[model samples]
Target: MSLEIVDSCVGCFACEPLCPNKAISAVMQPGEPLFFINPDKCTECLGDHDLPQCAEICPIEGAIVDEYGEALNPLGSLTGIPLHLLEQMREAECRQ
Candidate 1:
């Protein structure tokens, strides 16, 4: 299966060069520019690496996803913070 690059990508250019298939590229869309992955060219790095290089290298959580629409780098993955803890912190801030 292939991976998809969602709008959450901040155009950091971190995943482009790392892709073995050269599937990811910058898309100049109006309002906000973002990177995209060519589904036809994407192979989830099955033959190249243990994990998808793009997702492994992407700094933004939830930016890269599988064909099933599941995030490869979900929230709290890079931050190492639990989702519940983050939510609690937000609630505490709101109460202050």
Candidate 2:
């Protein structure tokens, strides 16, 4: 199974080097921002590590998703960020 880096990825470099398979690549295209993981190369660290390194190290919630496109790091799991606060922030951004 492969992990997908969703749009919520803020171009963080945290997940790059940690990838044992070297599947993660920094994508800095003018319009396409964020690091990308090559699904063909990604092994989810299955044979290397017990957990997917990217998901374990990602600071932002809902940034990394599984093969089924469900976020592995759902809201507030590691960061303890309140769901309401995130919703409010999104709403505020929409107003701007």
Candidate 3:
């Protein structure tokens, strides 16, 4: 299945070069904020790697989702911070 970089992406640019099929590219323009994956060109690294290179390298959890809209990199996959902790921090931040 093809992969999609959701709005949660931090635009770290870590996944661009790792793609063997050159499917991933920057979506940056004058005011654009993040990168995007080309579904037409994306193959989920099927023939080139064991897992999708974009998902493997992306540091943001829940940023990269599969065709079915499921996150490929779940909590604790990138950063060591757990989902619960992150949620707590976010809630606290909002209260600030």
Candidate 4:
């Protein structure tokens, strides 16, 4: 299994060099400028590291995901904000 980089990726290149397997790459397709993880080459860093280095280094939440489409770095993970509190803040913003 491999982590897939979604559109949310900002092409920051932070996760590229961190990949232990060299599975991550930059995709230059029009309107699709983002990093991609080669599934064939990806091993989820099982034997390499304790965690997936790409996901651990990614700055954007929900950018890297598992084969099942679950984000490795879900929202509120890197921000240190609880999901429920973040949701409440969003709701408050909408009411304003």
Over 1-96, each residue of candidate 2 has an lDDT whose tens digit, in order, gives 799998888887989999999999987889656789999999999989999999999998889999888888898798787889988999999999
The reply for model 1, stretches above 4 Å from the true place, is 29-32, 88-96
lDDT of 1 by residue, 1-96 (tens): 789988778888888999999998888789766888898999999989998899888888888889899999888999999999988997999999
lDDT of 2: 0.90
lDDT of each: 0.89, 0.90, 0.86, 0.87
Q: Estimate each model's TM-score.
A: 0.82, 0.89, 0.86, 0.79
Instruction: Give the alpha carbon lDDT tens digit for every residue of 25-93 in model 4.
Output: 887878656787899999999999999898888888788889999999888989999999989998999
Please name the candidate that would achieve the greatest lDDT relative to the true structure.
2
By summed lDDT, the worst window of 10 consecutive residues in model 3 runs over 27-36
The stretch of ten residues in a row with the least summed lDDT in candidate 1 is 24-33
Off by over 4 Å in 2: 31-33
Which residue runs of candidate 4 sit more than 4 Å off their true CA positions?
A: 29-32, 82-96
Error of 4 at 29 (Å): 4.5
Better of 2 and 3 by TM-score: 2
lDDT for 44 (candidate 4): 95
- Arranged by lDDT with the best first, the candidates are 2, 1, 4, 3
